[model samples]
Target: MKPLSPDVFDAAQALWLQIRMFAKGMLLPWRLNQLLAIAALFLIAHFAAKPIGHWLTTWLRKRQGWTKWKLRLGILIQQRVRVILFALLAWILVAVMRELTWPSRSQLIALAASIATAWAAIGFVTRIIRTRLLRRLVRWFAWIFATLYFLDFLTVAENLLDSLALSFGEFRLSALTVIKAVVVTVVMIVAARLFSRFVTRKLAKNSDIAPEVQILISKVLQGVLITLAILIGVKAAGFDLTGFTVFTGALGVGLGFGLQKVISNLMSGFIILMDKSIKPGDVISIGDTFGWIEELGARYTSVVTRDGREYLVPNEDLVTGQVVNWSHTNDFVRLDLFFGASYRDDPHEVTKIAINASLSVKRVLAQRTPVCWITGFGERSVEYILRFWISDPTAGITNVKGQVYMAIWDAFKKNGVELPYPQMEVRMLRANRDEENAPHFQMTTSLKD
Candidate 1:
């Protein structure tokens, strides 16, 4: 309300001039015309893209030769057809504008078109990447670079990224350097995995190569390739490896203390693979855990029990501890069942019946047959031992044993063979002098009564 100060008046006048200049720039004939053209192009594209995309997609689906390729292409069209059509139209419009020699607007329109095309391309690529985190990272990187390029500041941004660095002695690390290292490492790792799988398949197809040998080769190649990739990435990042000699020495000492069990397990895994002591599908028993080996990993062996439980056993345990490998040489296993019959029953008949019972079970090996013999003469019964062979201990030993026992019960019941129990006969004795004095003491007691 009062008279404004001199400084305030000057500042207000400057602000008013800036507002007028901004309005004037917006009102320029060429700028306004370019904006209108962009609007018009966007509207046309928006309306035309859907119908065109639908028609193209339908046409592609009709011409289906390469079944696998066509299926993949059909998916792409179904999801991104509109974006693809719009991008194409924008590019065509940009080209036409350039041909007309509209220098001021052509570059801007081309940049916009390029951005739309790049976005569509990135979207398609990210869909193929599969991993959510990796796809998001790629999307962010693509959009950032695209924006920088559109703004004509790509070189400046790169320079700034490179300039922001930290130096460690002769080694310098910058944002650009780190980015390059990460990209190179990721690419190398992916390539190594693919190559390893290809080599593994080839090795697996070779009839001469054992499965264990194939596994060993694949694992070794994978380790070497990954290590090589890391080294190459570090070198590309401009890191001087010679400077890390002391660091590595210290790291080794630290690892020795902290990762003794891990290193032992890793070495033990190599020993197991080399010796072929424990392999996949091999039935093994260690301590109380008995199961077939599902997988032999670097640190642990996956063992799945009959109860549908999987245990991750340390590799070192298999190397150092006593492990009973049922299928080490062959799947054949011998099981013994002990029973005794009443002394009154015919031992010969018992033995024959036991043999038939053992043969009755399906899992019992018929070629080897079964044997029954007298093991011991017990106090109450004659102990007989029934021995049978089974080819698949992995299927289970206890269940087969139980089945054979049930068969024995059925055979014994049908044959009228009696299973025996313990019986004791007790007798009491008196001293000789007590026996002699008994008649004299009995006469004296009768007179006293």
Candidate 2:
């Protein structure tokens, strides 16, 4: 074999020396003992986790007086009970071991405990996250960071990421900065949304507050919280606020041009809420869409029609266009209907029957009562107008009208009130004198009601 080059020989010798040093360190009595301790602890944790988790779940189930959300949280804990138990066990054992011996002797156990604790926390949080992809990303990110931290390489990684950066004027952007911004922004925004929902629900339950007022207050609170969240997130991400002044100015200009309708809709939402003209469950008619208000969004209003179709109408349209609010100030609605009877029927008796028929409908308001009057006498029938009041418009207008009409038909049939149909007559005459003298018999024909 040819003689080795000096560079290769030196590299091999250095590698061997490093290997020897590593072997020597591992051979240390304390190091070997700690390795054995860690292996034993792993076995203990693996076997003990199941029974302890079971016991915990059983105990939690047996408890009384827990709120629904509390019970839900308990269920989440129980699902991660294995990791929790392991974390507790490792911490307790490692603490006792550290006290009895040198703390450094139990470094492996301490590392394991830290990792277990982090994993348990991540497990619970990831489970609560609704998105599957997000949950997986968070889990992996947390595990990598925790492992890096325990291995003492987190600072090195951070420094490496920080080095990969771009500079513009006085501003610098890096992988670390981007990651921090995203994480901080997501966390703060999620917290804001959760808090907004909780507070909104509380406001909704307050009986003294009007529904529109509740909606307005909740929306205002949400807007404030989200704004604060964005600002705080940017601050936490280590950006220079002074440098962002130009960026914000440019952003405002972009929004003004690109989002004119969007901004209008948002502002319109606030106006709608403030004016108290419409609220949740109010029957409204906008152009072709007719329904009760289901919810008020920043950009749109949810209207659920009687046909079960939900239309998301833009808030700007609601502000600008005509909206017929049936239940604006009161539940009473006066509906006018036309009916006719034969001229033979007494107008007074027919009026009483029609009024009773309208009142007999379940939705017709008894306190307000129904009124009927003869409008005019047609050529063959008496034309009358029927008017009635309904307190619950949201129940539906068309259906109630049909019901009242049916009730009227039934009452008319029972009371012998005749509903007349059109009658027509045709007479043919011959100009001849002979035809005029020959007719003792004349034919008459008419349509019956």
TM-scores for all candidates? 0.70, 0.73
* C-alpha positional error of residue 275 in candidate 2 after TM-score superposition, expressed in Å: 1.5
For each candidate, the alpha-carbon lDDT, in order, equals 0.80, 0.83
Which candidate comes out best when scored by lDDT?
A: 2
**Candidate 1 vs. true structure, TM-score:** 0.70
Backbone clash pairs for candidate 2 read none
**lDDT per residue (tens digit) for residues 1-449 in model 2:** 75534544554555556557756876788878876876777777778768877887888888899888888788877777767777787788888988899898887778778988988888877665666887788788888988777766676567656655777877888878988987887778778978988999998789999888888888899899989998899899998888879889999999899999999999999999988877888899999888999999889999999999999999999899999999999988888888898777889999999999998888898888789998998866898999999888888888988998898899999999999886766676555685666535345767545
Runs of candidate 1 exceeding 4 Å displacement: 1-113, 116-143, 146-151, 306-308, 340-344, 373-384, 419-449
Candidate 1: C-alpha RMSD after superposition: 11.5
Which portions of model 2 show Cα errors greater than 4 Å? 1-65, 92-106, 123-143, 190-209, 287-290, 304-311, 340-348, 373-383, 420-447
Q: Which ten residues in a row have the lowest lDDT in candidate 1?
A: 440-449
